[model samples]
Target: MRILVVEDNLTLASGIERLLKQSGYAVDCVHDGLSAEAVVSTEAFDVVILDLNLPELDGLSVLRSIRDRKLDSAVLILTAKDAPADRIRGLDLGADDYLTKPFDVGELEARVRALIRRKSGARSPLVSFGALTFDLNARTLTSEQGIVDVPARELSVLELLFSRSGKVVHKHVIIESLSAFDDDLTPNAVEQYVSRLRRKLIPYDVTINTARGIGYYLSKASA
Candidate 1:
């Protein structure tokens, strides 16, 4: 999963970034609302952890901007306001979920996982493609033969491909999902990851079909 952490407090933002990264998410942190708005507009993020008391634009304005532009990324409001009215306001303005400050880390992680599942229309935690089974909760992949110890990047690419199985996923989407602002991810890098996954999935009757110059799709060979 990809996450954007927008918090003005350097300590809190760094802690959130580390926590999300430890939970196997590609994360980018912005200390101000304007930066967060600009990045969220251009880049694709699965979820945004937005703080209300931002430096430039404030969190409500930022959320409004995201909704106005029709960005589909899930927004979770993280603020110190624990009042009922504050929560209602955030939700009314298009926030998917709300977490009061000084929250539990485990709860935050669970919320993020839930949001990703809901956004992807994933009912169960396990995802199946051909003879391969991916345990979303455990973040593990297995085939009829045995386990597949795919690398982190390859695993992320496979997850995205599996989520949109049978569709041609554009390279740009994968790049954004896999890379953060500081990460050196490029088109060639995405190709390399897909190429590696293509060879790995062949054993499970799965195929990564290239759509010429367009992108790639996941297909199961007819038995």
Candidate 2:
């Protein structure tokens, strides 16, 4: 999944970015609200971690702009503002969730996962397809044999496919979702990851099917 971190605090932003990336998410960081607005307007992110007390423009304005455009990206407000009015205003402005300052990283991660699950309409953290089950919280895929050994990139590719198991996900979408702003993920690299994932999932009766000149989808291996 891809996430955008908008915080004026450099240390906090860097730490959040690092942690999310380590958790297998493609994360982009912007220090100002204007930069955040620009990036959100142009790029697609699964989740946006926003701070209300921002420079240039406030987070509420950015959130308003996002809602105005009817973008479906989930926004989680992370700020030191703990007043009831602040939280209510943020929710009214279309923020999906709120986290106050002095929060635990574990809770932050869990809230992010909850947003993802809600966005995907998944009832649980464990998503099952074919004979395989993927633990979104654990970021692992398993069959009856145990956890399938998958490279991080390949696992990310699988997660994207699983998110839309039967729908065609554009090749460009996969490339964008797997990469941060500074990441140089090419189409060729995406193909390699998909190829590896196909092989690794074969034993679980899972298949990654390609749409000619388009993208890919996940399905059961044909009898």
Total clashes for model 1: 0
Deviation of model 2 at 209, angstroms:
0.6
* Local accuracy of candidate 2 as per-residue lDDT tens digits, 1-223: 8999999999999999999999999999999989988998899999999999999999999999999989999999999999999999999999999999989999999999989878877778888899998888888898888988888888888877776666898999888888898899999999888888888878788898889899998888864
Candidate 1, lDDT over the whole model: 0.88
What TM-score would you give candidate 2 relative to the actual structure? 0.96
Looking at model 1, the pairs that clash are none
> Model 1, 116-208: lDDT tens per residue?
878887888788889998877667889877789899889888887777766888887888888888898899998898888888877788878
| Local distance difference test scores for all models | 0.88, 0.90
Give the Å shift of residue 102 in candidate 2: 0.9
Off by more than 4 A, model 2: none
On lDDT, the candidate that comes out on top is: 2
